[model samples]
Target: MLTITDLSLQRGGVWLLQAVSLTVQPGQRVAIVGANGAGKSSLFQLLLGQLTPEQGSVALPGGCRIAHMAQEVKASDRSARDFVLDGDLDLRRMEAELADAEARGDDHAQARIHGELDIHEAWSASRRAETLLRGLGFSDYDIGRPVSAFSGGWRIRLNLAQALMRPSDLLLLDEPTNHLDLDACLWLENWLRRYPGTLLFISHDRDFMDRGATHLVHFDQQKLELYTGNYTAFEGQRSERLAQQQAGFERQQARIAEIQRFIDRFKAKATKARQAQSRVKALERMERIAPAHIDSPFSFEFPLSEKVSNPLLSIRNGQAGHGTAPILTGINLTLLPGSRIGLLGPNGAGKSTLMDGLRGEKTLLAGDRTCGEHLAIGYFAQHQLESLDLDASPFLHLQRLSPKASEQSIRNFLGGFDFHGDEALSAIRSFSGGEKARVALAIIAWQRPNLLLLDEPTNHLDLEMRQALTMALQNFEGAIVVVSHDRHLLRNTVDEFWLVNDGRVQEYEGDLEDYERWLADRRKDDTEAPRNNQVTSNGVPAEASAGEGVGESADDRKARKRAEAALRQKLSPYRKRQTGLEKEMDGLQQTLQTLEADLANPALYDADGQARLKELLGKQAEAKSRMEDIEAEWLEVSETVESLEAELAG
Candidate 1:
């Protein structure tokens, strides 16, 4: 069991949590719910002994292994599978011992180690890690891809997979679904349900919390309160408590008002002066109950489109993809003024591809797409967050959309989205993912677009913001096409779902419940027919009769060798150029590091040291310049190499 006893945490001379005490039994799923900066993360740190609590103690069973998802992922060249496999420390240790035993020619020790590994079931660690990767929406090919090859969101998923690979007694997950697509979220829900360890996680997705957690711990008024049930039940309980508190506040206000009236009426009279003073004292001594603050910080709505065309956009027999590949073939879709559709599919099944096609950002491989002349688009994607001007304020971004709008009006509108005062005027370079997401959405809404193409718009948004968005969308008159993993948002906003599967898109007749059932049936079919022609998790043929650790036939081997030789012959120059660029960058980086070390010395500012400092700075600039050039060359070469490699592999 995990126990926190009268724990108090203070940061920056303020109490984030006070007199907080909670206990979580083993094998229990406890969700920590709170507003941002309410010390939920601080509590996790306290449990991990990363921070010393100002008061009380945290206790976990001795010898317990704890695992947590990392918020930041460093770029690396290591394969994704290897990174995930590295999480199993015990397996690695055993393997190391086995190698040592072999080197020492100790057959008995080697045999014993092998037996231990067998007992621990370490032999299938690679396969198990791969299984986890597949469940998390990684293709078999992606598992072998280098970490540097993935985007920030995908890298976060890699970190999650690594954490999940660990053998643990306690698991701590913080916003695990922030980067996940709908399919990945569904798979993760199933995975966490099967997790045997005690789980403590922080999430803003209410549905995910209700499904994943058995207990809810809410942070309010510098205090932690444990509730008996999931998030929904906690909300009900909290609402009732707030109602009672509001009643007490009203009574206190009324009593204070009565005392004030009496004091005002009697304080001027000679005989009642002393009595009035007593009444004043009583009013001052009265303990007050503060009213409940139930209103959400975020409250904004999309303005109705200027011209609501009968058909905002329409596509017929569309084939959408890049190059010669058709991700969504023979797709026919139409969006009218009130059209509201949610996209559902596994990752890489081309929901984003479909969105791009609809946005007119990508050229359709076949068929025609037509839109009304008055159609206006507001498109949102994770990548668009990157394209935001780091130096521009949210106010400026909105102004760019509607230059004629008054600054005060724009500021007032942005305040509803919680970008207040200096935050609204400051550059967004340092903003968090959620903040940037808000800015992007705000820009979209400012346009008053007739058609919205939202691809995973809820990625970094919190619960209140999500609720606000749901409400806004409910009232929106524009044609909406949104793809999100937040089921609550989907249930509340979208009226229909389009299932993208096997290079085709079609309307799914049923709701989310039926979709879940469909997934279950498909999974069952996958298990029963592991080698079907249909796409499975692996997307690879199941070679059942080929025996354990099957090898290719002689003819297959010869053909593979020929193909590899031909590809190498074709790609030799690009590979060599990449190698050359890497060497140059390595040397330049070393020189830069040496120069930076010299610049770090405090004495470099002295008059005598100024000359050497100037020289070193000059050299540093030169090295940096050279390094930039090398990096550009490397990027070109690397891209070329990757293109060739992909073609070869395909």
Candidate 2:
């Protein structure tokens, strides 16, 4: 359990979190939710003890251990297993001590060493580390890979795996799902559901929070507000609360008007002087509740310069892969104007290759790919940072992309995506992951292309930014070919899907979920359909997940079933735990509601009430601790069930 009292944090002389006091109870999953730059990350830093609050104290329960994971991870030369293996610092130290004792021929020391090994093994720490790594999308083969060889995104995944492996009583994570693909995110959700520790994390991914976090904490304007429920539930409750607050404000205004009337009527009368004076005092002392204002900054729209009646881009009898390694073959499809197409597939399924091919970057052998006239393309690659000149400022990137554009135009474009002032002038090499993403988007926006090819565009964007981007894209009158695993973004923005498997593209009629089912069905199909010559407007194969001569068998079928079932079972408790945590979080929020109400009373700011407020902070900490305990217990139960199931399967 951890407690914070009168915490205040400042960055560059501006208060980020002010007078913040809260508690995190064992076994509770708390989600920090807010718009970008609203102190959510700052709070996580405070909790991690990475940055000390300028004006308060954080107290952890005696003997409690803590682990923290940031939004971005940096790595040198190390494999995934090496990264996770480092998490067991205590184990390594203990082993070293035992080795030294054995070399000295101490029989008692050897016995003690054996006992220690037994205790460490009882925790199944090494096994758990392996499982966590696999869950985060690293294969067994990838376990020994040097960290220096991994792409930045994959390195982040490795960091996540390592963080998860760390043994601690309380775990704090900042945007843990930023780089995870669909499958990995699901696996993480399942793992966290059963983790036997207090959980607190900052994430912009609604699906991630919905799947795991029970309580939502909203940080804004240097203050923290608690909401009891998952993100969706919190939104509902917050809306209702806002409505009530508005109603209360209206009633108070009406009462004040009546009081003013009474004052006007009785001001000249000695008998009514007391009444008039009291009314005046009441008006002066009343603290009106302010309504919440929601604003979106993403508002750029594509200039509908031209329209194509047939497909904007078409492919016929297309085959794509490196050398003879065909990722997808016989691909045929047409991306019509105004169609929002989502590209869905597993990792290493050639989704990226297809996108690059569409952009005319990759050579497509055995396929006729054609682009419509007047097609101006804007691309957002997953490795966008790699594309940027590290030495240039974000403004410079925009300028390079649009040389004739005015300085004001560039700054305005940057500001729209939450980059402004000094941030725009910051070198691309020095920017944060999110900042770089914003800059990349700003560059794309300046070009104002009609055909948008987005590869995981939502990466590094906060929730508000994601929503804003979604809204902006919804209005664009152009073709959108997006490759992403974010279900929510796919559901909201995509009208159709192109599923790639085994060096082929399968066109689907509906959304990503439907495409996923179609892929699943293809896996279940008994008859291995021969490669048909018939191709659609776009040159893509109609089959699913077929690589050239990668034969399937009954064992593969059994394995697929097992994997799918395990995925569902792994996620089940986390889903249930998320629900339970939301309820508990809501209970704790009631205390905050009371505190806010008391604060609204002008009298509560007086000296006596200030002391009482500090006392109330203690109660909040207690509530936080209790919530954490529940989260830890939920994690234990979830993990226990998973371990038992794994044992039975073994």
Best candidate, TM-score-wise?
1
Query: Which 10 consecutive positions of candidate 1 have the poorest summed lDDT?
Result: 525-534
Worst 10 residues of 2 by lDDT: 524-533
Candidate 1, lDDT over the whole model: 0.78
Per-residue lDDT tens digits for candidate 2, residues 161-266, read 7677666777888778778876567667767887767889988787788779888888867887777778766766654566456664564465446445534543
Give the winner by lDDT: 1
The Cα error of candidate 2 at residue 406, in Å, is 5.4
Please list the C-alpha lDDT of all candidates, in the order they appear.
0.78, 0.67
lDDT tens per residue, model 1, 157-247: 9999888888787889999999998777877888888787888999989878889989989888899899888877676666566656565
Q: Residue 326 in candidate 2 has what lDDT? A: 63
Q: Report how far off residue 385 is in candidate 2 (Å).
A: 2.7
